[model samples]
Every structure is written in C-alpha cells, then in structure tokens.
Target: MFTGIIEEKGEVVAIERTGGGALLSVRGPLVTSDARHGDSIAVNGVCLTVVTAERDVFTVDVIRESLDRSSLGTLTEGSAVNLERSVRADQRLGGHIVQGHVDGTATLLSREPGESWDDVRFSLPRPLARYVAEKGSIAIDGISLTVTTVDDESFGVSLIPTTLKLTTLGDRQVGDVVNIEVDVIAKYVERLVARQ
Candidate 1:
C-alpha cells in the first residue's frame, strides 16, 4: 500500500518488450537508493514489483492486463513519471490510502489558472462517477488530490504550486491521458449498499 505521496519524479530509461509482457527501467535516485529486489513501488499509480535494481535504476515487468489498463504501456524512454515508495508502517498518512491500483484512466479536459493555484478539470469515466464526491479524495497519476467539483461526466481539482512542480500535472495538456484511482473505501461502501 501507498499514501499517494510522491517521493520524486523519475524518467523512463528503457522499455523492452518480452513475449507476454514488457520490462520497464526507471531512473529514480531517491527511490532506488535502498530498493531491493521484490520491493513494491508506485509508478504513475500502478504498483509494480522490482525485478532488478542497480545504481539509480530499477526494472519492473508489466503484464498484458496491467498494460491494457494503464497509461504506463504507452510510456517511452525519456518520459517523466511520478514515483513513490510504499508508506512506512508507523508514518503518518500524509495522503489518503492508495493501493497503487489504478481503476481507470481520465482525460484532461481543461485547466484554469488562478493567482495561487490552478483548477484542472478531467473527464471522468461514467462508471466511476458515483464514487467521486465533491471534497472527496482521488489519486491522479499517483498524486493525491481533492475533488473541487463533480458532475455526471467530469470533476475538477485545485492544484497548488507545490503539487504542480512536484508531479506530472505541470506538463499535462488537454486530451492527455492520466491514471486515476478512486477512493477505495467508496467502492466498499457501494458494495455493501448494493447487497442490502
């Protein structure tokens, strides 16, 4: 599990296609400093196991199913990605509980800049709409953000300068795809209600 707290921004150094999957090597000095084989790391909201670690880079194999569900499949060498290590057992949860299990992808619809921050609106998938509420939490590309507003088709989130600089949102443009993980608690609540 992760707290959706980004540790550092990493760059994809290589992506090799295998018979049934692909191997991704990312250069993240901070996250790789103590990373060992089999450690879990969140890459753009997708949890992947470390297959190999050397120097400032670590490699993970992405299976066909994960590729089909995330934007990671489209990444190429030199692409920048958000990276986060698993939260410690005793550390305070800086962000909400994030499983690093992306539910789906969302598209950047527009961005409105403010004096102190920017409000980014994203196109929400219909199936995930009900789980998102105004002021609720959502993980976008592994960064935890709050929903500023929500409607049937979209939701907006206000981003502070720190967030913009620390994560990939600073480079996002209209029509770009991003990984999204809705509040996991909401899904459990929905399941309980449905069985009633």
Candidate 2:
C-alpha cells in the first residue's frame, strides 16, 4: 500500500524489451536506497516488484497487462516518473490510501495556472468516471490529489506550488497521458451495494 505521497522524482534510465514484457531500470537513489528484491514500488501509480536492486538503480519487469492498462507502455528512457516506497505501518498516512493499482489512463485536457497553484483538468475514462467525486481522493501518476471538479467527461485538481515542484505533475503538458487511480473505498462501496 502507498499513501499517494510522492517521495521523489525518478528517471527511467533504460528499457529493455523482452519477448512480451520489458525490464525497466529507474534511477532513484532515495527509493532504491534500502529497496530489496521483491519489494514493491509505485512507479507512476503502478505497483511493480523489484527484480534487481544494485546501487541507486533498480529493475522491474513490466508485464503486458500492466503495460496495457496504464501509461507504462508509453514510458521510454529519460522519462520522469513519480516514485514512492510502500507506506510503513508505523508512519503517518499523510495522503489517502493508494494501492498503486491504476484503473485506467487519462488525458491532460487543459490547465489554468493560478498565482500559486495550477487548476489542471484531465479527461476521465468513462468507466472510471463514476468513481470520481468532487473533493474525493484520486491518484494521478502516484501523487494524491483531491478532485476539485468532476463531470462525466473530465475532472480537475488544484496543484499547489509544492506539488508543482515535487512530482511529475508539475511538468505535465496538455494532451499528455497519465495513470489514474480512483479511491479504493469508492470501488468497495459500489461493490457491496451492488451485491445487496
């Protein structure tokens, strides 16, 4: 599990494409500092297991399912990504609970930059739209954000100066694709209500 708080921004240094999968090597000193083989790390909101950890760079095998589901397939060498270690039980939940399981991809529609923050809009996937609500927690590229506005087609979030400076969202451009993970609680509530 993760708290949607980004620990650092990492860069993809290498991508070796296997037959059907790919091995991704990311340079993140902080995240890879104590990372071990089999440890889970959130890379751009997708949870991937550590296959190799040597020095500040680690490798993770990207399966076809994960590649197709999220924006991982679009990643290439030199891509910047949000990185976070799994939340420790003893640590505070600074952000909302994030599973690192991306539901779908969203397109950056537009952004209205404020004096100190940016009001960014993103196209919401049709199936995932129902799970998003105004003021609810959402993870965009692994960074937790509250939905400031929501509609059937798109949603918006206010990115403060800190968010703009810390995570990859700060450098996002219009028309760029990002991984989206709606609140897990909403999905569970919907499932339980459906069974009733």
Candidate 3:
C-alpha cells in the first residue's frame, strides 16, 4: 500500500520489450536508496514490484494488462514519472490510503492558472465517474489531490505551487493522459451498500 505522496520525480531510463511485457527501468535516487528486489514502488499510480535494484535505478516488469490500464505505456526513455515507495508500517499517512491500483486513465481537459495556484480539469472516465465526488480525494499519477468540482464527465483539482513544482501534473498539457485511482474507501462503501 501507499499514501499517494510522491517521494521523487523519476525519469524513465529504459524500456525493453519482451514477449508479453516490457522491463521498465526508472532512475529514482530517493526511492531506490533502500529498495530491494521484491519491494513495491508506485509508478504513476500503478504498483509495480522491483525486479532489480541498483544504486540509483530500479527495474520492474510491466505486463500488458498494466500498460493497457494506465498511462505508463505511452512513456518513453526521458518521460518523467511520479515515484513513491510503499509506506512503512510506522510512517504517517500523509495523503490517504492508496492501493496503487489505477482504476483507469483520465485526459487533461484544461488548466486555469491562478495567482498562486492552478485549477486543472480532467475528463473522467464514465465508469469511474460515480466513484468520484466533489471534495473527495483522488490519486493522479500517484499524487494525492482533492477534487474541487465534478460534473458528469469531468472533474477539477486545485494544485498549489508545491504540487506544480514537485510532480508531473505541473507539466501535463491538455489531451495528455494521467493514471487515475479513485478513493478505495469509496468503492468499498459502494460495494457494501449494494449488498444491503
């Protein structure tokens, strides 16, 4: 599990294609400092296991299913990604409970700049729309953000300067894809309510 708090902005170093998957190599000095072969790392909201860990870089295999579900498939060698290691048992939950399981991908619709912040709107997938609510939490590319507004087809989030400077959302442009993970608790509640 993760808290959706980005630890560092890592660059994609390499991607080697295999028969049914690709081996992803990312340069994340902070996240790889203590990483091991089996440690879990949240890469752009997807939980991937480390296949190999070196000094400042680690490699993980991205199966076809994961590539189809998230935006990681569009990544290239120099693509920048949000990186966060799995939360330790003793660490505080700075963001929220994030399973690193992306529900789907959302497209950037617009970005309205403010004096000190920016309100960005994204096209929410229809299937995931009901899971999102105004003022609710959502993980976008592994960074936890609050939904400022939501309509039937889209949602918006306000990004502070710190977020713009530290995460990939700062550089995202209209039409670009981002991995979206709705609040896990919301899904659980829906499931329980359905059973009643």
Q: Which candidate number has the best lDDT?
A: 2
Q: Per-candidate RMSD vs. true structure?
A: 0.8, 0.6, 0.7
Q: Which residue pairs show backbone clashes in model 1?
A: none
lDDT of 1 by residue, 46-125 (tens): 99999998999999999987888889888999999999988889998999999998999999999999998999999999
* lDDT of the candidates, in the order given: 0.94, 0.96, 0.95
For 1-196, candidate 3 gives per-residue lDDT tens digits of 9998899999999999988789999999999999999999999989999999999999999999999999988999999999999999999999999999999999999999999999999999899999999999999999999999999899999999999999999999999999999999989999999999
Candidate 3 error regions (>4 Å)? none
Those runs of model 2 whose alpha carbons end farther than 4 Å from true positions after fitting are none
In model 2, state the lDDT of residue 136: 97
lDDT of 1: 0.94
**TM-score of predicted model 1?**
0.98
- Model 3: lowest-lDDT 10 consecutive positions: 15-24
Count of clashing residue pairs in every prediction = 0, 0, 0
Residue pairs in clash, model 2 = none
Q: Residues 1-196, candidate 2, lDDT per residue (tens digit)?
A: 9999999999999999998889999999999999999999999999999999999999999999999999999998999999999998999999999999999999999999999999999999899999999999999999999999999999999999999999999999999999999999999999999999
- Give the range of the ten consecutive residues with the poorest summed lDDT in model 2: 15-24
